[model samples]
Target: MITDLIAGLFMIAGTFLMFLAGLGLLRMPDLLMRMHATTKAGAMGIGLVMIGVALHFLEAGVTARVLIIVLFVMLTAPVAAHTIGRAGYFVGVPLWEGMLKDELKGRYDAETHTLASPPEHQNKEP
Candidate 1:
């Protein structure tokens, strides 16, 4: 059936993303980059896998559970990554040597332990 085909494709795609995420985590040079790999690709991979599960089940209870799992992963992954990265930065975790610009270089006050946006970012209104 069409649903099975779609679900299979999603599962395959999710597996591929997870594989790439693993490779990236191993190959990336810095903590931030590795976190990027794990959070972004891993989250997407898991979300897709959940979507495939939901599609394959096609039951109200199973679909709802899968959807909730996906939503929680999607919501938390980025925030978790950001929080970890910020903590690492605040603690002076060295960035990769190849890194060009540090946008947060002067944006943070070490003594105050507070972060402020860049001038441009501050001026912009949401």
Candidate 2:
């Protein structure tokens, strides 16, 4: 009984996060923001859902598959998001005007399509 209740809670929470991801995709003003929202929320939602499934099943094979799927998503989602964001930036997609910081400013060489590392003094975080 308790296991079922916990599983139900996990599923509901995961579903809510998934819904928020969709809403963010529609509502975010820029490509990077939208990507950020969807990747973070979607991966987390998948992880939670998988946990619930594993708990509910309590079977070796099913639980193993769930763990693998969750691990894969956790490993890949951030890397994929970063790659997509880099691609978008290189393609000249504009950042939101309200953005506070641009760490990449003046670092990219347009002609060679390369990025130089920040100077020694600028390396310190603000």
Candidate 3:
């Protein structure tokens, strides 16, 4: 049937995206770049997989569950990435050299981080 064929197509496309994400994760260099790979591929992979799976089932409950999973992935991916990035920065993982400017450099004075922050509203430490 045409519907079955469409569903099969979705599954193939989703599988391909997931595989590409895996490749990005493996090949990307540096934490920031790798993080980019992780976030993009992760979201796309899950989204396509869910879309494929949902269409394959076409059941209300399964569709709802897949939607929920998609929502959860969207909500958590950024938070997790920020946490990991912060940890890497605090632990002193050097950033890639192609980066022309480091916005965080002013806030961090090499050996110690300034709690005062660069924000205009933040009070400077005396």
Candidate 4:
């Protein structure tokens, strides 16, 4: 009885998280921010939903399948997001104006490019 209620509640929570993930994807601006929203909310949404489903099923094979599904999502989602984000950067997507600092920008600038390449280094050139 109590377990059923708890499982029901988890299902509801997971559904709400999935909704929020959709909202976040629609609302967030820029590639990086969108990816962040997609990764965080998407992972939690799918994870909790899978857990709720496992609870509902409550049998060996079904639960094991759910666990496998969760593991796959966990492993793949971040890698997909990182690949997309890196590709977006390479393709020259403009960042949102609100970004106060970019650690990647500093690292890429300092470690690569030349004093004559572009932007920050151009000023240092003769």
lDDT values of the candidates? Answer: 0.93, 0.92, 0.78, 0.81
| Top TM-score model | 2
Off by over 4 Å in 1: 116-126
Candidate 2 wrongly placed segments (more than 4 Å): 124-126
Q: What's the residue-level lDDT of 72 in candidate 2?
A: 98
Q: Mark the 10 consecutive residues where model 1 has the least summed lDDT.
A: 115-124
lDDT of 1: 0.93
- For every model shown, the clashing-pair count is 0, 0, 0, 0
Candidate 1's displacement at residue 112, Å, is 2.4
Per-residue alpha-carbon lDDT of model 2 for 1-126, expressed as tens digits? 899899989998999999999999999988899999999899999999998998899899999999999999999999999999998998899999998998888889889999999898877878
* Model 4 RMSD in angstroms: 6.5
Q: How well does each candidate superpose onto the true structure, as a TM-score?
A: 0.86, 0.93, 0.80, 0.80
Sort order, lDDT high to low: 1, 2, 4, 3
* Model 2 Cα shift for residue 14 (angstroms): 0.5
Model 2 Cα displacement at 99 (Å)? 1.1
Query: Relative to the unseen true structure, what is the C-alpha lDDT of residue 64 in candidate 4, on a scale of 0 to 100?
Result: 94
Candidate 1 residue-wise lDDT, 1-126, digit = tens: 999999999999999999999999999999899999999899999989989998998999999999899999999999999999989999999999999988899889999998886788667899
